[model samples]
Target: MIQLQSIVKQFKSKNGVFNAVDHVDIQVKKGEIHGVIGYSGAGKSTLIRCVNLLERPTSGKVIINGVDLTNASIEQLQQSRQKIGMIFQHFNLLKTATVYDNIAIPLKLLGYSRQDVEAKVTKYANIVGLSDKLASYPNQLSGGQKQRVAIARALSQEPEILLSDEATSALDPETTDSILDLLLEINEQLGITILLITHEMNVIQKICDYVYVLEKGKLVEHNTSIDLFTKPQHPTTQKFLNTISQRNLSDSLIEQLNLTGAVIRLTFVGESTGKPLIADVANHFNIQPNILAANIIELKNGIVGNIVVHINGTPSEINAITKYLTNNGVQIDMLGGTTNE
Candidate 1:
């Protein structure tokens, strides 16, 4: 439903030219929840802004539903934006306007009739679970409630694509979960293509079908959420994964263990998760497997699992065990320990 082709957005800084969004391309299918992740200054916000032409790109194409929005005229761009809704980290509600009016503003500006505007406002307010707060002002609502108002306002236009720029970052963990759940519901029920930006990996893990990792304005990595989470390739990607999982064996632990035998990181996906894969592997190879650490989590796609183990055996036996696990669909990575080979 949305495609960004070789998109670039550069700014003239006192130091020199800076590219906030470097050459990046993205494709989000219809009804898919796509996530973009990066830390502060990662260009995620700027890239998202390019989607709606809020920040005009310096080069490349912004295509939505096969129409090149990059070359669209003012009126065309305005019309196209009607189908592209955006919400921010901060709830951008008019402080003085009531919830009802805040949601109605877009429709009203589009020349919607009073009756139509009223109907849309009420409908979206209920959709975002804020019908009771229709008369409440921005200051009267909690952070979560204010976000609901922002969501209602965005949905008032019935956008086909929702761009969420750190929409849940300001909420507490519980509230963040609620907001993520709501986004999932919206994607399932409304079939809106969602492109969300977040610094939180857990948020991406919870809702994204596909993920794109950005670093210093460049697209560093892209993959299905399950694949990326289970076997992240890039160093930057690994760092992001570390936020949700304990990844490294401390120098002290390695030293205390004498760094003998092979320490392997095993990742399991699909039906392999929660099974006695480790025990089976040990028994099959006739090798002792000392489990160092393990983590398992359920994602929207499937169960993903990771485990670290210290295996002691002859070189041939260790090689055979690795092959055996590979045949059964376990992803393995040697994390600096002992590999007889």
Candidate 2:
């Protein structure tokens, strides 16, 4: 397990003291993959480095497996860090070294026996599907293969936690998916507590069981992946969700034109039965809603849905329908056209 309490990291910049990570608190439970997301300059990288004492926090606690790393001695921290392995966005490998040696480096540093290092190097390389590339150099491998080599290197040490800092950012989409799948597989089979930091919401959505949204050194929102995806509360969080499910300005205008009256965004989740509720609205109000843009992304939670619709009816009728829909557990936001909420 990993925890950061009021973690702060500041650097003396030309303009002033710039805080890369400010008063941030995070807890990554054992056996769960937690995601941290933010745009460039959002301090996500700095925050992760602070975790293993790679970069010391100015004032805070970095606790790993019950050890407070911030206050730990160099010897203590070094020993603790061996249990926390990290991989970079760029595969930081010795280009001339074979994949076998690349992975063996970490074990070698720990003073592992030559035989033990060889066994682990081979085993981790195989785990990452690089058995054939053990003798291949970094330059000869593809981006994904190189990343696998890096992963094998990190896992070769057999760390309890893996801090993946934008580990897939440099790869193509196909390769990105492959890397993410591998991370998930590692988490599932190895039960390694992973803290994956990236600007990519899609990555977080795919592998993260829980996620936190960070902006300008502050925690904007944090929740389980399913809850955050279905019902994002913060504006920053909404923008991140919209990155993958972008609703264009032109699309909004089209919905407005088609509806020509009241428009509402409807969301459905657990205990909010949408089919019967919509049927009841139709029967009671004699109004049909022209559904505009609709999307249903299944999460670990039950099927959650969002739809843009134009309800055609008299003013009073629309008001009645809105009230009826709300009483049934449908979360409706009046992204209105002519109607005022």
Best by TM-score: 1
How many backbone collisions does model 1 have? Answer: 2
Tell how far residue 281 is off in model 2, in angstroms. Answer: 4.7
**Clashes by residue pair, model 2:** none
Tens digit per residue, CA lDDT, model 2, 1-341: 88999999999988999889989999988999999999998999999999888899999999999999888898998889889889999989998799999999878878999999989988998899999988899989999999999999999878999999999999999999999889989999999999989999889878888998899988889999878977789988988877776322245685547555677777777767447676677778777787777776555335566777788676787878878877877777777666433
The TM-scores of all predictions, comma-separated, are 0.96, 0.91
Pairs of residues clashing in candidate 1: 261-338, 262-338
RMSD of 1: 1.6
Q: lDDT per prediction? A: 0.90, 0.85
Q: Candidate 1, residues 1-341: lDDT per residue as tens digits? A: 89999999999989999999999999999999999999999999999999999999999999998889999988888889999999999998899999999898888888999999988998888988998999999999999999989998899999999999999999999999999999999999999999999999999989999999999999999999998988788898999988888766766787689756778888889977867878897677777798888888677788888888888876677778888888888988877666555
Model 2 lDDT at residue 290: 78
The candidate 2 region of ten consecutive residues with least summed lDDT is 246-255
